[model samples]
Target chain A: MTTKAKRSRLDLRNGRIDLSHGAGGCATDQLVKGIFHRAFDNDWLRAGNDQSAFAVPAGCMVMTTDSYVVSPLFFPGGNIGSLAVHGTINDIAMAGACPLYLSAGFIIEEGFPLADLNRIADAMGAASRAAGVPIITGDTKVVERGKADGVFISTSGIGMIRAGLDLRSDAARPGDAVIISGSIGDHGVAVMSKRENLDFDTDIISDCAALHGLVAAMVEVAGSSIRLMRDPTRGGLAATLNEIANASNVGLRIDEETIPIKPEVAAACELLGLDPLNVANEGKLVVLVAPEFANALLAVMRAHPLGAQAALIGHAEDDDHCFVQMATSFGGSRIVDWLWGEQLPRIC
Target chain B: MTTKAKRSRLDLRNGRIDLSHGAGGCATDQLVKGIFHRAFDNDWLRAGNDQSAFAVPAGCMVMTTDSYVVSPLFFPGGNIGSLAVHGTINDIAMAGACPLYLSAGFIIEEGFPLADLNRIADAMGAASRAAGVPIITGDTKVVERGKADGVFISTSGIGMIRAGLDLRSDAARPGDAVIISGSIGDHGVAVMSKRENLDFDTDIISDCAALHGLVAAMVEVAGSSIRLMRDPTRGGLAATLNEIANASNVGLRIDEETIPIKPEVAAACELLGLDPLNVANEGKLVVLVAPEFANALLAVMRAHPLGAQAALIGHAEDDDHCFVQMATSFGGSRIVDWLWGEQLPRIC
Candidate 1:
């Protein structure tokens, strides 16, 4: 009867994941205690129960989930680990909530490198700590080789919405001002460069960072004045704006010159024949606020590091068509349509 | 500017999933409205927010998450969809909580059939409705073909524990009686039969079910006397017992003859060279309760539809080694150990 203390340490540097890591046995316990437990290191997780028990504050609760299957698990600036944490946190924060706790589920392909898994866990732990959120409970499963990609992470988060704040997609009004937190297309281009093996003189890094603090700051300054908030992810700014337009039954008018895009991302989009407006951004958020509070909200956003590139890029109007029209730098107007097909796959 | 009402219907019968379905664009909206929305129709889901916001009752909350990558999405008596729902529900119920809401995250392989996806969603919806728990929020991501098996569903569930109940894994005490709700190994054998393409004279159906009602009934009868409860999943009954023994620092003495096993499942396990105690059971639960209330708890469990075959299988004792010893039907004693490796991968 070998106790956990007597078991030898896992071969973290060179060993590959075997079926036992997720078989719910001794090996699985060792993997969890050695890797996941050490990384997450929370009291709730240490309870060793199938579920994490906690107390909920008296307020509206928000819940959201996302699965990260981004290819080339290791991307510039962030990997699937950090992306999984930040993505769900941002989703909850978009509801004007203070992110509370998260639960992670991991599916690892058999023979995946233990070192890589360790790195991903480390990144996830770092991201969770940075955002002041803890991963209270989690599950891990391993599949046969080729039955799964290297690894896929699914994260679900619970948050508490601030009282008196009623933010919803349908809350936008005709006079609302549309603001973006930062440059777009960086996350998509960064992942594409690594996946397609494209190289450029300048580095393109994914803008994957937790935005809950930035959202907290914004909500502090303008609580009910903010109509809605969304993180431009898979379908990017174009899809987000279109969703808002359709949901709110309003039209949007944006100045192309005001939208920020990194030069490397712009060049990559041109070379790849992709629209920068349709590319994803992990760390950026778009907010629609009442006209009177837009400037003050923008000022508050600019004070946060994640929102240093904040800009008011658009405005909503009462148009029967419910279209998102962009005033191009060429002095021509064109509709920013939703992405037609897969511009990029597995970009998280 | 085609509104959702005007958009053409999805080709659910013959169309295959494309990257566009998960692109978070118009196509994604169509998929959501056509399939997910129609299946999981609820006011919170229809709110069209990135996160679902709702009021939670004041109590201790239990949260659990599990990712289902079961091969052959469809199996006898259940599929991955229903299994995903039941598995998480049981996890939360084991903590003596009333399951509340769930959030689903799906990773689909490009070119997968839309019909199958719809079927899975339908099963999930049925399961959610049957359990009285709504899947309020969800996310979808599509990966390139060969990057994913077919579809993997990760579900996170939140439940509210009744006031004054404190269940923990380490709560077992000497003289606690160990009870099992029903026959084990049906789920694992059912999945293995499909995966291995084995035939049997009698049908072996998976015992995947939501156990919240059974737990509630038992809690009503033996509230404080109930030390702990767990569903023997993944590594199965042997692993679950070992976990409890280690956590509570107590030993277990089991009578193998008293443990229930369906003849077909027993035959299947024998033929496959698997131990019945080491196979998964989705609908079953193992409870440790005070000795004085063991009969009352067993009667209550047996009265429930999900626990018709409930039996008292063992008892806890104080031992320095904290081992689980089984008195075999052959009059020999053997230690029950945790599964060393995967008995059957992707068994859910």
Candidate 2:
């Protein structure tokens, strides 16, 4: 009988993934020990159990999950691996929580390059480490070649909510002030630019970064006054505002002039006939705060590097119909409606 | 402006999944509220926040994740949805943890039938409810046609460890007893029978079940003396036993005559030219316990419906090389080595 120590190392440079790598056998063990174990080297993972057991602090815990199927697994600024980490971390951060750890589930198609898989895992590890959140445990499964896109990653994060902070979507009142952390449409445009059909030249990069630090700063300053926070991801600012308005049962009024948009992203959105308001942004947040704390919160947001482009763009008011109305730069007002359908598919 | 109330209802009967349902827009909202909300109805989901927040009991927590890509999603006893929940829950249960909540992430292929999707979600709801665990958070993403086969579900579960119980894969000591909860190979045979290439008729049903109850009973009876527990899912008894042997650095010796195998499963394995020890069983467990408590634990296992056929299969022994040796019914012994490659792909 061949010992595990005598088994061959994975052909990381030239080999490709096959059915056996996920079949819960020697090959699967080797792939896990060689690739995942190397990338996510931590005590919990090294324990090598079906589950990762750890001691979490006593507090209100938040859980969130997101599945990243972004096309062109490799994108500008970050790939799917990094995006998966940031997206789920941001979800926890939206609850005024400090993300503790993450669990990743990968579904890889048969024949995917081993090198690419290694790169993705490394990126995931780097992102998690940078955010101080580790990928504690994970599961991998492989499908037939035609059954899946190259790869898809689903991540679930658990976080500890800050003490005395209860941020809820319905917590916003009629007099709350609305703020946005940064520019919109960069992530969508960056991914779109890489697509084969779009022929636009732009240097836009996806603003995909863990936002817990900025959230921590905001919580430190205005924990009680902050109504809620949301990252405008898939359907962008328009969808986010509409949802907030509906959930809070209040009308939101914003000035389109105050909304930040990079020149390249604006031009690309115009060329592509996509509204900047409806384009996705990965590293932006829409925040609602009490009217009295609006200026202080804005100042705090702008103090952080991630919130350098922060703007107090809107306010909430009583309306029988919870409409998000925007004062357009064209000297006219229009309803910032919820996105009706698919604007950009697979744009994480 | 069209109000949300004016939107048309989702046609659950005849509608097919489209890109818009996963685009995080009004369509996505409708699908979520109309289908998932009604299925996994709970307070956390009703809050409609990006994350679910709740106070958890202070203790060591176990987090586990699994992405289910079972072929022919609808099996005899259960579908992919229930299986996803059971699989992750079992992972946690193996660590003697009481699963608290679950987060589901679904990746669906475009043009898939909404009726089928609803059925899957309902099955998930029913499974979680029956298990006394709730699906507190979830995500949905749709891919282009043929990018995915039907649907894939990834679930993450967090569970609180039972205070005083610490089950580790490497905790098995020499002179410990190895026990199997029930017969093996039922799940694999059941799935393979439904495949197109295989022409066979049998009343075999997949042993897809949540084994938390049995685990709780074992913890109640032999918590301190239990070394470890593992579900023989993918590579079956051989793979699980081999993993235990390698992790604990102890040799395992078992008599083939004592291993529980249903006559039908044995016949099916014989016809398929497969070893019963190498076929998967979703609801079976291979447990290692101290020799003093082996009989007591086996009696308690036999009392549970899920473990009616509990058997004391083997014993761990000291050896320079950690090997799993089994005495065959023909009075010969052979190494029950780790499975080399894919016996059944997508068996989970």
Candidate 3:
């Protein structure tokens, strides 16, 4: 409140945060001006409008919104900022759409570091640009110092859908085959490693990449074998598989040996007393395909860098209970129930 | 960490959060089963599937996503839950669409009152039903005790865009008039009043209602003249007008007296030393128009209860900097600058 306190704040690095940081005036401006805006400087963001105004390419547009509240905002390979872009872009792409614009609304804790804020914003901007989408407009609000944690990003994305492709979870049909675009649980384990500070003796980078490009590739190849697609996010593969099974009124038979799991993830799960299947994944998709095209789809998926570890793991069968049964690794069988509860809360 | 802690926790209601709450296991399951799943019970939600499968009416569909973390989740007229639905629906409706299915993602603090969450979810469900939309899918995650406030709701909405309405913010044109659907700042003031605990209160409930029906009405009547529409959510009218002005490359001339403001809002602003222009409005919108159809648009908007206070707020003028000059209540003038400082943080 006084010049003395302000001057003392000079001693604190951009890495530190104090009560005054969230004050709704010059202090807050310094945070936005001296850091956030600088790192996120771009034509759309610099315009400083409440909502970004941009041209949507002529066609049917797709819009999606996601809120990112990952704990330990600074994670191993990714943070909440980049996670926001990846999540929203995937939602748009899952609908057979091309992501075009984004709107970011930030809820910041009062005493968050300017440096950390800069890193997050830059990460978001970079991720958006790399995905060929732009962070078009934004809103920022700072709650009391103890009222929030670091920062939370809520993103609303608008995209355009090309003609003809309609993607939905309910599209899965009886007898449809199941395939995974790549290895599962890499992202969940990476974030878990960062949060727990567990020894990452075996470097496990988060598989937190945008999937719109991969979705585009799949659409180009499989015209229609893609009965359904979903990114197994929070509850991971078990949850996604169970969802599709129930939605289509079918049971899935997943071969345990065919499923891909990075050794690091498997090892981490063992240490934490958790299941790799229940862990989160930011860059893997569960694809349901018609039986005839299952192998062809897997081949197409395996061709891409993102899909290099693709696998045909399961098949659909007639069943009202929507069971997700799996052949056990040790040669037994078990029902993979819908991941019944929260795994890691707010881990993006 | 022990079996006693898990079994004993089944009946306790007043206990505080411990570390196991954040651990990914049975503890999290007890919490979701006891609190979240109980509050949000419905056929699709109760199905316990990871993703909800649902249907939609025939037409071009519109989907929107918004996250609400407004401080003091309980406001004058609503909580974060209802606001989440209203905000996302307004976005879809702003596209001249009818909202259909909704999905919600929540980040909740561990000690949040189950009763409060139940009430909020009920409100959201009621709002959805009233808007003729269903919250077909949702998710709940419990953050560590200090990582979040009571709760934050992110809703993704899908709707059917009516035929022939090409609605977009970029659709504003030169010589188009600007109309506000109703009084501004009610929602922002309502939340702020509740937050600050100001005794100076009126029954100034948040004008936080769904605008889809009102939008549908306007779209039916003002079809082509309705060049652009934007709800003044974060930055309020001043910021929204400025955005439209710059987007259309036209300056705006507005009559101060012509803009609608409730008596309570005006009094509250004067007492709090705040400007209503910079306050957010959840229920109000800035509707751009062609000169000739301004009256018809106002008539249509006024026909609805939500738009009863609709008025011609401004008109497009020729200027490059996009100055938003207002004709004062006293017939003099002043520039309505963009909200240069934070009005209220997390005011939603």
**iRMSD (1 decimal) for each model:** 2.2, 1.6, 7.2
Give lDDT tens digits, candidate 3, residues B167-251.
Answer: 6656666678889988988888888888889876467788888898898888888887778788888767887786677667788
- Candidate 2 lDDT, tens digit per residue, B1-348? 564654677999999999998999999999988888899989999888889998987789999999999998988788999899899889989999999999999999999999999999999999999999999999999999999999999999999999999888899899999999999899998888776446555578899999999999999999889999999998899999999988899999999999888898888888888888888888889899999999999999999999999999889999778999999999999989787678889988
Quote the positional error of residue B201 for candidate 3 in Å.
Answer: 6.6
- Output candidate 2 Cα RMSD: 1.4
In candidate 1, what are the lDDT values of residues B1-348, reduced to their tens digit? 433433556899998888888877777787887888888889887888889998987779999999999988999989889999999999999999999999998899989888999999999999999999999999888877887888999999999998899999999999999999999999999999998999899899999999999999999999989999999999899999999999999999999999999999999999999999999899999999999999999999999999899999999999878999999999999988776667777788
Per-residue lDDT of model 1, residues A114-202, tens digit only: 99999999999999998899999999999888878999999999999998988988888898999999999999999999989999779
Query: Per-residue lDDT tens digits of candidate 3, residues A1-348?
Result: 222234323322545554334433345445555555665566755644333333333355545556677887877788999998888788677766777666666777766776677778889878987888876555555666666788887776666665676666667777888898888888888887888888868988888888888888888888676787888887778877866776678889999999999887888888888777777888888888778888887787788888999998988887777788899889999887654346666667
How does residue B291 of candidate 2 score in lDDT? 98
Docking class for candidate 3: incorrect
Assess every candidate by TM-score.
Answer: 0.98, 0.98, 0.77
Q: What's the residue-level lDDT of B194 in candidate 1? A: 90
- For model 2, the DockQ equals 0.75
